[model samples]
Target: MSKFDDLPEARRRGLEKMEEVYGFDMSDGEGDFFRYTADHLFGDIWQRPGLSDRDRRLLLIGLLAGQGAADVLGIQVPAAHANGELDDDALREIVVFLSHYAGWPNGARLNSIVEETIAKARRS
Candidate 1:
């Protein structure tokens, strides 16, 4: 009965992948942005076989951090941890490594987000 039930196979797979990656039901999302996110980003890109989800997540973390995308990182960092893709130590190391290339300010922001995400997980 989900909206994705009637979608094309690729779209359905994409939505399912989004749920798996984000660890939540995403079938209620709507609109073009949602469609592209599920269908293209998740379906076509994330589904590609060249890299594991963990690999992709690591690359994405660097890209997002370099772009100073704290809001998106807020979602991605926790999801990465919850999915067992990145542990607290690995996350902390990324902050140190990317600081040189992505700039100290962006690295500082990443550090904050990483610590907050780890602390929240510990409290749960």
Candidate 2:
């Protein structure tokens, strides 16, 4: 079956938000990775019934921050914003809140990345 076959609604929204923020194009050569992300990450994981999308985004922010995954976090920040999962204040607060557990350097770096992402989003 195709990756999209029986795709859950939450997964579809997640992919749409990812594309909107990251300029993702499934037609691009990175089909395998994209399909894995869509089929497994979003389709299965995001479809789990407990958390709301906002809750998922908040958890993602913390996890990405702790992992020092600034590049991915950069993409996620805007995606959360576009999805109405996070606002500017909430984004800044996440940096502050995560700084204690994720370390100052990671938080500082993410703060800068988040600012840049927000600026770019506004420009477009």
Candidate 3:
């Protein structure tokens, strides 16, 4: 019924980290969308027909850059790093990649977040 049900505990732990550390607040939803997304989006969907985790990470980084979601980028950049989704160079690549579509300011902001995230992750 939910992807969480089938997900490995490690990945589920990642989900919990995202929710707790990032304040995802899944409880606000009425449907099982949270579980569904966790399972499907992060678990099955990610493992199935969608792009590779690295690509998804790239997509997320780029999308976040486009929206100038510096906060989410700050969080996800480290999470994405923890998951081995992108190396520092690769992460930088995504931020650079975004400059073409999103503009310099958004890319600049995301670059700052990425740098801070990488630094913090290195400490932890």
Candidate 4:
């Protein structure tokens, strides 16, 4: 079996999805960061065995929005949609809900990224 076969189901799915969503190529120059993302984030942490990927995606959106990480949102928002982890209404609700806790500015930035990513996804 491949190393990928050794990964837990959630981690394997998350890893494949991350590559598809982020266009991550571990062979690229950013090997260290990609490796950590693969080994720690997806391989270990995402395998914790409780919430589903949809639940995790929701939390990730909240964290990214709260931290003003719109750029990362550019990737994650569409990925959530593509993978069936989020729908349009759920995405909108997330923005509205997080606006209070994350602040309007961060929410606005995330909202913009969400729209742009959704549009891009539709076009392609």
Q: Specify the highest-lDDT model's number.
A: 1
TM-score of each: 0.91, 0.73, 0.65, 0.75
* Tens-digit lDDT track of model 2 for 27-107: 222467776776567656776799877888788889999999988887788778766678878888888999999999999
Which pairs of residues collide in model 3? 3-39
Please provide, for model 3 over 1-124, each residue's C-alpha lDDT reduced to its tens digit, 9 standing for 90 to 100.
4344455764564464445333444322234766566645554555555566567667777788888888778777877776766778887887788877999999899888778877877888
- Candidate 4 residues 34-113, lDDT tens each? 66776567666666789887778888889999999987888788878877778777888888899999999999998887
lDDT of 2 at 80: 86
Against the unseen true structure, what C-alpha lDDT does each candidate score? Answer: 0.91, 0.74, 0.68, 0.74
Which parts of model 2 have CA positions greater than 4 angstroms off?
1-25, 28-35
Ranking by TM-score: 1, 4, 2, 3
Can you give the lDDT of residue 21 in candidate 3? Answer: 33
Question: Which 10-residue window of candidate 4 scores lowest in summed lDDT?
Answer: 21-30
How many clashes does the backbone of model 2 have? 0
Candidate 4 residue-wise lDDT at 73 = 87
- Tell me the lDDT of model 1 at 33: 90
Error of 2 at 30 (Å): 6.8
Ten residues in sequence with the least summed lDDT for candidate 3 = 21-30
Q: After superposition, how far is residue 120 of candidate 2 from its true place, in Å?
A: 2.6
* C-alpha RMSD in Å of predicted model 4 compared with the true structure: 4.0
User: How well does candidate 4 score on lDDT at residue 120?
Assistant: 73
Of the pair 2 and 3, which is ahead by TM-score? 2
